[model samples]
Target: MQVKLIFSALTMATLLGACQKAPEPVVTTDAWSPLAQRYVSLVLALGEHDKSYVDAYYGPAEWAEQAKTAGQSAADIATAGSALQAEIRALSATDTMLRLRQHYLITQLTALISHAQTLATGKRASFEQQAQQLYDTLPPQRELASFDTILAELEALVPGEGDLTERVVAYRAGFVIPQDKQQQVFERAIAECQARTLSRIDLPQQERFTLEFVEDKPWSGYNWYQGAAYSLIQINIERPIDISRAVDLGCHEGYPGHHTYNALLEQKLKNELQWVEFSVYPLFSPQSLIAEGTANYGISMAFPGEQKMQFERDVLYPLAGLDAALAAEYAQFLKLMAQLSYAGNEIARLYLNGEIDAATAQSLRQRYLLQSEAEAKQGIRFVDTYGAYVINYNWGKDLVKNYIEQGGSEDERWQRFISLLSTPKLPSSIAWE
Candidate 1:
């Protein structure tokens, strides 16, 4: 009986040993870094197909040439991208940074491949669908009627108006920064923005950017990152410049915004850790969500509370040759209008999906979001050019704002903001708690 029991135990042990699984292969092998490099190079090559595909590339110039040569066609690039992603999926990495970076690469590659396919096929996706697949997030589903409540809230703020949008437009018309004053006003605003940002975060000694005003661009502003602690920022002068835009663009295009965010990544990842993948930025990828969201949120983060209004009241208003007494009213208008930012996505959906015409979309933006006719055109133009990217401004702003404001004190918020700017963060990284 003892021998039979022992034999049974041995048989059980044998079965248990056989059931144990072999270790799975991972993508983080020794060649993984090189694969990452090749991926960036291929993306740069793919960028040649679309003028807006590659937002910035400060990597090895040789790699750019290689991308153009090796992955010359969109189909070829897509095939290579898919194969690389498969290769990455077959491997594992124990390190957190490696895993996150790999995931970021794969996510961006997926967008690139999809874009390539769309370009080749000449078939466009719905705004929401494209946004989800490319930017890695969805714009909140909303209807035109959904904004009536929001417009009512704004109406309660500003009474005695033919139309709330018209009234808001007329009220803000006086605050436009004159053509002659645009440069000096923007320079001063950027200086203050830089000072405030530097007071909160640690950045490299040589970090800086050159500001230029340009016209006829699809977007209002752009930061052309040059890598190695420098950026070239362009502000659109296609329409009348509002006084409030000084602070908005200052924090957005300069300090603690795109310039600051890009510089930190370049310094920490590319320079320090020698991570070559950080050298390329694709405008259509998940990174833009973080970029635009943090930038919009940075304005509030840097200027917090009544300080923004006070700063404009004390400095920007006077600089723009506008009456200072009305700053308070303008400030209130801005506060009310900010609440309706999500409406842009719905309007874009309606317009892009053929539910509404261009004229209808423009009118909806003006009525619900409270913009001037010129501003309405600009808003619609932006939608026409960038589809669901409209969400990056408000939805992204809300997400970043919620994440940073989780802690109580102002310093804690700034710390969280700084951490987010420095790291390779994704949409899920900042999901509301």
Candidate 2:
């Protein structure tokens, strides 16, 4: 009887141990993960809904393809998007890291659905409303008349009989790089930009890019981020290529800008952390605020005030065969004119919401912004196509510059700047105000 009791006790302990062992944690998407499949659904559904929705996708193409094969109708997609958004909203995870990632996915998916609904309904949200919902920030738009002070300042710098616009145009016309020499000058400019960025930010050894000068693009320059630390940089040549644009374009498109931002995120987030959200870049999202702001701010970080002027006069002016004597004057005028940058946002608001007609928008561009007729028309065209995206340039630059410069020393500022470029950050992440 004692022997029987011993055996029974051992069996009971074994049973207790079996009950204590964890029922293997449900992790990894392949093990029937609703979240993973839902994410795949949004990507594919958005792709069908709008051609511009998926900016870059290096994920399993089969997933998107499978969703496309399902052939969900527009109504079906909208419904599914709404349902998934609700699910993500209700979802919770015990792990802190998982919770944050889930939140990011939820926030992005919600925006995707919001955009999809707006697209389907053809109901235009106000510029502020749309920018807030889609990009996660509202621009601090100023009155166009407020820019009179800045324009007056620029007028003094020009000192000409005709309108300030014409004088500024004729003066700037001297700085245009000859068509044949555009490629050579841009190449050197980007090279210097890369060197300067590397001095501060340590990029992946494999990071590299190809530069092309293309025409007829809406924006001045674009960086098409091909995954794995590669980017295709295109410069819009339709606008007269100016020598002053060399450093700005170089820093914006190459080093410490779009290319760097993309590469760092790809390396740190996608590669190391295996976060799938970073794998796809939606063009209209808040990420653009970070991308454009950091990129615009990068120009100054790479080449600060007197240094930029010296670089232009020393390297770019000679390369473009422009008058080096006018570099200083052009620099001052450019600084004064940058204040008028916010004017474009107001024009965009008016044009998009039907407060002003297209012609008036273009006309105002020439008069207030001091753009040439051709340039002004192009500027208005961008506003019509991109809507409140115009705010990304100046607004983004201000936010990033303030954030970076607020840190104590120049080195500390760069550290903050690089940290921004490298991390999985949203506009809200950096908001001080």
Candidate 3:
């Protein structure tokens, strides 16, 4: 009986040992998971380094940090809940879509990584050298023809402090406004913008006008990048809308402008892998050209069938609380002023880039922009830092506007434009009829 019991115990041990599974075969497949993780980490580091560039124009730092946390699904969401709660208490609250996008970016990355890993466990995507070429190619725009004319008109009004270049650059940079009137001018400018747009958009009366104003002056002319929200601030300066100039700036910075277009593209690229490459915002190449062109032209999209008269009489005049008769007279002057500004922007670009001289620069601004010496000086600083991008503002607008006109209906134009905007790759130039 003892021997039999011992035999049964031995047999059971053997069966248990056999039931234990052996280690599976090591599969050598292309895995993108590790690479995705590495890429996200790199992007986050870049954001940290570039934070200073966007400080004034952007919102609080906590919001961007919260977004960074949100973009990592592998981390515990509940653990970061407190940090997000803190961000909500700040001045610029995160919107629902932004929050969702943060997580969506990470989750999408997980899937991409998994797919890539299954195909080849070790291979990863490499960034191309062509990325930096976009920035290097930026050359200034020239408005020599108009600048010559405006110089004569403005020379008598304001004492010519030398030439157009110096005066225009200085004035544009906030040098012209008296210290006391700066805030007043800024406030009134913003108020006028809000009032102008309230009646134009097809929103219900109850849903009308909740325009959120941030300090746009500091970062008004620069490109915005993503960290937390797709854009931390609206670069839209609420200047008294000169119908034409307002439309030009509005299109470049607002609806069809930088903010709107970026938000749209970011939303489309919510996938993790896409965010790693595209959302980081390299300043050069076809990307800026396409982005600038589309945004510069967006004014036409938002105000299709818009007339210059309606812009001034209906929108701009009402916003400033001006009388109809006085408004009409002022509107014409504003239109001329704006066109002059645009033309001067071109001249600034040429002069700063060494294509033109200081004398030529001054001539260009004074003649084209109708600059007081102070204003022309302000414009000079702008052209120096930015280079030829000024041309993009007007040239892009013309290109897109013409394209839309030739393409027939607004919807049709948009359909074609959307296709262009949707690509992962950027085109060097926009095609127009």
Per-candidate TM vs. native? Answer: 0.89, 0.87, 0.51
Task: Give the top-scoring candidate (lDDT).
Answer: 1
lDDT of 3 by residue, 1-433 (tens): 0011011112344434433332221223323223323333433432343342122112223444654655443233222323332333332316543333343333323322332232233222211111123221233344366455655654443324876445544433322233333333333433343334333322111111112233324234343444222232232333322223444444454444554455445444423224333344433224455567777555445554435446545655454444445544444444445556456555654564467877677655655665555445556655543344455455555555655566676567776566445444333223411
lDDT scores for all predictions?
0.79, 0.76, 0.41
Alpha carbon deviation, residue 12, candidate 1 (Å): 78
- Sort every candidate by lDDT, greatest first: 1, 2, 3
Candidate order by decreasing TM-score: 1, 2, 3
Give the residue spans of candidate 3 off by over 4 A.
1-230, 234-251, 272-275, 305-312, 326-346, 355-363
**Residue 154 lDDT in model 3?**
48
Better of 1 and 3 by TM-score: 1
Backbone clash total, candidate 2: 0
lDDT of 1: 0.79
The digit string of per-residue lDDT tens for model 2 on 1-433 reads 0011001112344334423321222235642256645665666667776776677665556666876788766566667777776776676666645565565666566567667777778776778876787777788877889999888888778866778889988878878999888877887888889889989988766566767777776778888887767677878887787798988998998888999999898777666766656667877677788899999999999997689889889888888888899889889888888878889998888888889999999989998899999999889777766678777788888888878888898899998898788765566667432
Question: How much does each candidate deviate from the true structure in C-alpha RMSD?
Answer: 16.8, 15.1, 20.8
Tens-digit per-residue lDDT, 186-265, candidate 1? 88888899889989887776566667778877777788887766677888887778899988998998878999999888
